[model samples]
Target: MSETAPTPAPAPKRRSTFLRDLVIIVVAALLASFLVKAYLVRSFWIPSGSMENTLMINDRVLVNELVPKVAPLRRGDVIVFRDPGGWLGPGMGDDLVKRVIGLPGDTVACCDARGRLSVNGHAVDEPYVVLSRGSDRVVRDDFSVTVPAGALWVMGDNRYDSADSRVHGTVPEADVVGRAFVITWPAGRWSVLSRYGDEWDGVPAP
Candidate 1:
């Protein structure tokens, strides 16, 4: 009788080294992103209509947290800051965003001879001002005040609906959080926020 050939031994099972490496890579990436957000930049979401026509409700903004450490805030810069007058109310949190209209030691007023806002005796043409709801009306209120030293005068674009400097007075410089640089969400609306304008350029320094 012929002897049967011995069956070959089954091959040893292999380890899933690829999957293990992939998991490690993903974890590292997430950690790096968190560090950057906490120290360099942060994402903020708009919760009200205060900055309408410029930043709408639910809009996503990118703030450069490192900016305050590197440079001083300038006129016309949109900034996120802590509430100064307790206007946000208790348990309502503290952060709010508004446009910088007057710097320390500068005089700011509303409703010039042409119904425009003025800064440091110069009339400012604000094309971005949002009109009141259901009417072709602009905020024509008369107000005049000098921004105190180490403070800022800010306001919202939607003047009729916003409760800002007009109601709370000036904000201390230390209250400013950071400068808004970009709108990143709602893919179709992505754009860098610009701080330059004819009026902004002509604003006199304190």
Candidate 2:
């Protein structure tokens, strides 16, 4: 009866791996963040008042890199791009943000009696344009130009103050980095950027 075999040695205890699992999770999260920043979205801060009430100076925005690549651009979509040469002067940054005013082959003009910008001969209701500091006008310049193929005419909500396509000329589509889709910083300023498609509803194709 006392011949019971010696108790088998206690099975070896498995070591806890919480730290290993945690490290793996952290690494994976970081990698995913890096990938998103590199190919899906990126953050940029407003360096000036070009976008105004829409994007104030120092506002942080999230730009979707898929746009104008996976998604075609639309008039009124805010975008970020490299300066198309001579657009930026000394001390100015190479990258800038503006709203699409004209697509390739579209004619863009300013002030249609009612102070509205016109696209393809149709007046657009630009509720976003800010009135000049001391005047009732929104746009300070009166000009017209047809956007060339593979280029886009852009402008700012602060029309009178922005040095945009009006001052520098159309930006090549190739120079666009992405479309800015949202304001992410300054919790009070959080909002989705609008394409203002309705403003272009009456605009005819060019």
TM-score of each model, in listed order: 0.80, 0.87
What would the per-residue lDDT of candidate 1 be over residues 81-162, giving only the tens digit for each residue? 9887677977766799999999989999777656678788887777677976564434647798999998999988888888
TM-score computed on alpha carbons, candidate 1 = 0.80
By TM-score, the best candidate is 2
lDDT of 2 by residue, 1-206 (tens): 57777886534432236667788999999999999999989999899997888999999999999988899998999999998889878988889999998999999887777777889999888888888766655587688899999999998998868988877888999999999999999999999999888886668999
Best candidate, lDDT-wise?
2
Q: After superposition, how far is residue 166 of candidate 2 from its true place, in Å?
A: 1.2
Clashing pairs in 2: none
The reply for model 1, stretches above 4 Å from the true place, is 1-32, 133-138
